[model samples]
Target: MDIFDIVGPIMVGPSSSHTAGAVRIGYIGGKLLGEPVKKAQILLYGSFLATGEGHGTKKAIVAGLLGMEPDDYRISDSFNIAKEKDMKIEFGEAKLNEGHPNSALLRLEGINGNKIEVLGQSIGGSRINIAQIDGIDTNFSGECPTLIVHNMDQPGHVSEVTSMLAHKSVNIATMQLYRSAKGGNAVMVVECDQQIPKEGIEWLKHVEGILKVTYFAGI
Candidate 1:
């Protein structure tokens, strides 16, 4: 374990899991949306839903949706900031069949009409695990430049993505694959050691059988 594991993240917080981790969950969700967040619906579960208010969880999430980091001084004033920006936000509780206790689900709509749903969990020390995207179960830490590809489960698709990354000289740190059913929807979660070039990502979008591609340039 490193210093962060020992001391937690540098953040404005009453609790690392409730505040800092919640901010990160929001931040990643906004990034996945790929544009400024115009509307957001956040659902907290377990501990977050029970006692998150006193820990500044709501404001922290709004701050993140507004592009603020965990250490942002304005986290406490995020509601006002969001109001000033005309960003609409709503909060509620979530009932899930299975998930970590410190979890939240975010439905975000971007200014450009783009939308995304993210389910994230805070595993302490301000670390997070993004469990699902758009209803697809996934497993990836947002600690690295991550490439999320939604595609048809077919032959050559995996090789195609891997080959492209190989050609780009981007090394994969970790990768996970998930599918709804055979020949159905599939998702590729690739955490890479190097930043993927914008053009490469654009090219991947047009590939046949590829439905969607979302990239997160690490925090």
Candidate 2:
């Protein structure tokens, strides 16, 4: 294991999993939304709800939705900042059928009327896993630039996306696919070796069978 794994991340926190990792989770959720966050509904599960207040879990999540990093001093004052920005924030408990204890569910509403749902779990040492997106089960650590594509389940969609990425010279390090049923809603989750150009993402958005394309250029 790496030395950082034993030591932990540099952050403003009483607990790495609860505070620092929670911030990252919220930040990633905001990125998925792709616009200014106007409303956030956070659901704490298990350990996160048990000891979140003392660890600043809620505040850290707010800080992230506002685009602050883990070590941002502003995390302490995130509630006030959110109020000033006219953001609607709420907190609650969650029950999941499966996942880590330090898990959270974030429901975000953007100013553009866009909505996103994300399930994030903090494994340990400030590392996190994004377990689900928009109800699709996924497993990605957000350690690299990643692309999440929501598309129709149809022939040629996968090849079309892979071909496009290959043409753009973007290498896919790993990829996963999920679907609701046969010939139904499907998601393509790709972890790339390089940052995908904005043009490539835009091009994917316009693809015939593609419904939505979300890109996260690492944390």
Candidate 3:
């Protein structure tokens, strides 16, 4: 067995499948939010809904949503942190069966009120499958320097986006594109071998036909 098979993962857990994985989901999703979470609705499905509280999944998730990384020692103190940070948190049962057994449907409103819905699953090691964003199917792994770009599905959109990245000397390590059909709506998910800077993000934001840009570094 390899290291992961042996050690499973470095995490806080009574059960990794339930606890550590939930924490990972929170941490990754928190980063995706781009700001502190002012309010959060965590919907646990099936097994998670049943045993989450006993497993400490709720506390783990709250910690993650507050921008606490997976390896942070402060996870156990998440409740106190939540009070200190003035974050509004709640838990409820969700009937979402469209994902893995350890899945959660998150409705998150950021501190600025810019909100989004994220459906994520913790497969193991706190590793997750970020399935959907705002009702669109996407393939984003919290790995590498990744870019989630939204835009109209026009012919030249991909070229334009990549061209800008090329100009900035960013090499694409992996890329995924999905849309309803040609020229309708689309999202380009790119994982880069190098860091994408603030200046590049500004350039991407100003690009014509670009709808939104979210960057996940060292994913």
Candidate 4:
């Protein structure tokens, strides 16, 4: 673990779980949605639903939906500001096992009819995980522009995508490649240090064996 993880991320906080981790999860959820979350249904599961109010989880989620970072001063008034921004928001309980304590499920709908679903978990010290994006199970922390590539399970596709990123001077942080069956289907969660260009996107879209390319950098 990095020093930040030990001491915690530089952020506004009455509690790291409700504030920083919640904000990060919400921010990543917004990013996964691919646009501003005009309307959202936030379901708090397990620990989040239990102690979320005192930790300001709801307010932190709203802050993230409005594009405010955890360190931003605006996190305190996110609920009031959400109204001014015309964002419709709701809070409720969720169905979850005892897997992760700070878990949440977000159903976000954008203005352009783009719909997305995200399930995230805040472990501790203000860190979280993006467990699932849409129906794909992924392992990413949402610290970068993550590319969740759904493709036919085949050889050389990973190299091709990595080679493209290398040509653009983009750096990959952590990559997790998973397959349900041989030559059937696969998923690659590539987190990058830089934003992906449209040209790169077009290239990846047409790559042989690649079925879908869902890129989520930031909201």
- Best-fitting candidate, scored by lDDT: 1
Q: List model 2 lDDT by residue over 1-219, tens digit each.
A: 889767756799787888999899988889889898999999999989999999999999999899988889899899999999999999998878755889999999999999999999988877889999989899998889999999999998889889989999999999999998899999999999999989988988999989999999998
Q: Which stretches of candidate 1 lie over 4 Å from their true place?
A: none
Task: Rank all candidate structures by their TM-score, best first, as comma-separated numbers.
Answer: 1, 2, 3, 4
Each model's lDDT: 0.92, 0.91, 0.79, 0.83
User: What TM-score would each prediction reach against the true structure?
Assistant: 0.97, 0.96, 0.89, 0.84
| Prediction 1 global C-alpha lDDT | 0.92
Q: Whole-model lDDT for model 2 versus the true structure? A: 0.91
User: Residue 68 in model 3: shift from native, Å?
Assistant: 1.0
lDDT of 4 by residue, 43-160 (tens): 9988889999988899998888777888878898999998987889988887766647788888888877777778888877777888876656778887778888889999998998
Decoy 3 TM-score against native: 0.89
Stretches of candidate 3 exceeding 4 Å from the true structure: 1-8, 180-182
Backbone clash total for model 3 is: 3
Which digits, one per residue and each the tens of the lDDT, describe model 3 over residues 1-219? 467646655666676767777777787777778788988899888778788889888888888798776666888889899989898887887677466778787788888987877777777656677777766777666767878888888778788878888998999988889887788778888889998888888888888888888887854
Question: Model 2: which ten-residue window has the lowest total lDDT?
Answer: 4-13
Candidate 4, residue 191: Cα displacement in angstroms equals 2.4
Between prediction 2 and prediction 4, the one with superior lDDT is: 2
